[model samples]
Target: MEEAEDDLALLVWGQAEQRAAHGDPSFVRGLAAQLAGRHAAALEQARDYERQLAHVIRILALTPGRDSLTQLLRLLEDTPPAGTHPGLRTSFIASLLAEHQLVPDLVATVFDRREWEKLDELRACLFHELLLRGADTGTRGPLRDWTHVRPGWHPLAWLPAHRRDFEADARFPSRSVRGSASGVSSQLPATGRLDPPTPRPSQPSALRDVATVDVHETIVAAPQAGGWGACGAWVFLLDHALTPEQVPALLPTLPMACVAGLGPTDRFEVAARPMDEIWHLLFETASMGGSHTAGVHGAYGRLWAWRSMAGLSGAPADAGAAEVEQQARQSTWFHFEADAEWFHNDIGSDYGIAALSPDRRRIAVLAATDTD
Candidate 1:
């Protein structure tokens, strides 16, 4: 089956075996473009059968629903498809699938006979309306501050759910509020000062600026005026498991090939144009090392990917409001770049070399690095 033929067609799979190894859809446009006469008619007929019943029946037959364990039990109650024998299937799920968020896990563990015996003493707590009785805990904190009907206005019978607004001299006799036996003139305990509110604490304008996500990272000192159009991060291989705090230092190396991201595809969009020679260096670097070995020091082989960004230049809000409108043509993706090439900020092992154009023109250099 084409579905089961997990051959070498996947790039991830192929490269994975090497490093050990190395390494949408869109609809077609134009009605006339797709309608190719007789072939189109034949396709339409076949699709019509599929859109009606053929595809549905095929899917139903194959699933009978066993792609997942939950579905396996349901299907086995009858007798079904090609994937598993019910007995072994049950054991397999009990081992692997039960650990995650599956309901069967709770059913097997928490409700086991031992657990049931422990909770048996609480039988009276179950199957009953839990009417909480006694002095109200309402006088505590926010509950006391919460505005409610002035107390003693009505009989306690008015506590029924739908019973609203106590009547004056009807539900119960109203007493004087200026001086009542229930400490009417006495104020409830003051939880907080109400003095014109402490002139609201000042905001951290400094931190707010950092909190604002500009999505801007200066890729190089190439000086394209507003900023660089793209940026990426790469880790320089960890000799050991690094903690979260140690991560930002290595984020600056992500190359263009990290991933192509969301939205519509454009023939015009590309990580490297023919003129971008930096791309050549990236491709050569990625391909040269089939399997990773010692990078002089043991520190070199542990490198892993972080994240990448590309597509569309942004303009300063103060100066280029007009130019920002042209950026609608840009897009980015993660994991794989579809039809794009890979490249880093430079070629070779120079710690702080500059990025170059395809012709080797010095467009930008590592002016500085921003860790966070």
Candidate 2:
């Protein structure tokens, strides 16, 4: 009986692969059902169970039908041990589903079933993938609403509040250029213009006098796209006011008195970036999920990071997004391309942004680097 079962498993997997390759949906659906039945039987008998279950999931991932997805979700919901992290179960399934041609249908079905919380990681992954892939008009409304209603701590919670800005950025041709170590010139808006730096403060503030902001708490609370990384924010009180052209020259001056050293400045090619572009960069970076983890803060991390930067620059803590963005716009913003060496483990992700506050008296540098 064991030998026969093994033969059946091999036959099913071989046929499923062959049919899937040939675009034979009907055959694939039939095989998925067969595997689902085998999964149920294996569960009942407790023999060769895990292998049988993996077969079902593999076939179902390729099927793309609503029924197949439902079955897959049921397996995800019911099979894991009580203490198993939801992310462990959801990551594989989310990755498989993200590639399906019928993503809108799958998303609608998941929403209809009200499985958002139980499958929260899956839902977040789907949303992030959709955004990355450029959600079509039909998909945007529901996705926007999903962000609005999703719990505040959800990684994507920042989407609804900045929908207009995000949509505008999405329309820009440079939006697709992500964290390239070569620098962010390609990601800048078409204008490639920075508002002139705000006039220097009447009285220069001393570095020791600037209020201390807890940047580590703000940036580390969320999971970055490249996996585990280090975040550091510094406040610099400059004797001279900064110009857009001069911001890149300020990197080496940063006091590496702490553990998180300055990033790879020697390798970086820096360029002035508009405030909106920088905001978009922060959102994209924070919203990214690691290879084996979920994006904990999703879109929400942008606000968290922004607020911290604002506090470092002496903006009001309760300032709205517009006010904060305006403040950043008046500052000198620079984006550079280089491995974030401060992380110690480099996985080709290097994101660095520096801003000389509008007052030109204070400079805030925020950098995050990670490995997947």
Candidate 3:
């Protein structure tokens, strides 16, 4: 009974704070949670708050979807003290994390080591929460490996090639100075401008290599793309413009299918999870998994170490760290074919967490903006 009073007290205080300034969402959110816990007693207050929240939401509805998220973030920032409830602060910050598609500048604040450990998880957790609430990122493809079949020093050749159709939104182009933003063709949209689609490439390339790769969804990754462009680990950093020749000194050792192309602009997303999350994914996979495991291995070590070595420096790995990182990144090479419309949420997955516009039926590669 006493606990009920305490919870109600917290809710009242939170509700009061919410009224003072709709700016600090933390307080209101904290109150909402507290009220939810004391559902029977806090009925009146909860309804009042919900009505208020819904009302303000109407105002927010006026903004663009992504913009509304930004406004919420700004509202939180403007409130020096979001409120007394730590839960409230979590709720406010969480809104910003899930609502915005890819706010590079705002998210950069997450790296603030001093406050990072505390705020970092709120983002990941909330993303999943949003998913539970039916926030669909849109399916793109199956989570698996690509088999690379090629006779060359390039390691990426070992991975499988995505069928040209993998990019339904992309078109094949000859003499493309640079790949399109969607990475296949820029002049054409994904739906393929139907004037009797463009002719197949005259390059006479044998695409038999497309069969080697795959996906292993036995375990799961986060729902939305979080880091730079997905594949949100050091492999992302090593991506700073590697050459076809240089790809091997840093990539897989197996006989490759073929190396297509990788540039400096790639990205990925990963949790700042305890060193353990990395450890588990590295140490616990099935026997076929080259060097990655998932449970105890991750529990007892630091996962980022392997990425630093195998990724950035292109040096050989330490005793176990090297193998673990490599396998974790590469193990999912098993093929699980599906349509882009079904896997848009997992697009750029080879790289990291990305939210592809499943409805984006067209694509156009932007002209080179960086001459360097």
Using lDDT as the yardstick, the better of models 1 and 3 is 3
Q: Can you give the lDDT of residue 206 in candidate 2?
A: 30
State, as a TM-score between 0 and 1, how close model 2 is to the true structure: 0.55
Give per-residue lDDT, candidate 3, residue 239. 15
Please provide, for model 2 over 1-372, each residue's C-alpha lDDT reduced to its tens digit, 9 standing for 90 to 100: 222567667767677788788898787676667778878986666544544554456567657688888777777667642323322345444544655537667667665436534766566656655554556523456666666566777544433343334334421111111211121222323344332223312232234423254543443333333243555656667787766566654454355332123333234345677666666566445444343333433333344446544553446656665676667667767765442346433433445566778878776666665542
lDDT of 2 at 304: 45
By lDDT, the best candidate is 2
Error of 1 at 88 (Å): 27
Model 3, runs deviating above 4 Å: 1-41, 47-325, 329-372
What's the TM-score of each model vs. the native?
Answer: 0.16, 0.55, 0.22
How many clashing pairs per prediction, in order? 13, 3, 72
* Candidate 3, lDDT over the whole model: 0.27
TM-score of 1: 0.16
Better of 2 and 3 by TM-score: 2
Summing lDDT over every window of 10 consecutive residues in candidate 1, give the lowest-scoring window.
Answer: 298-307
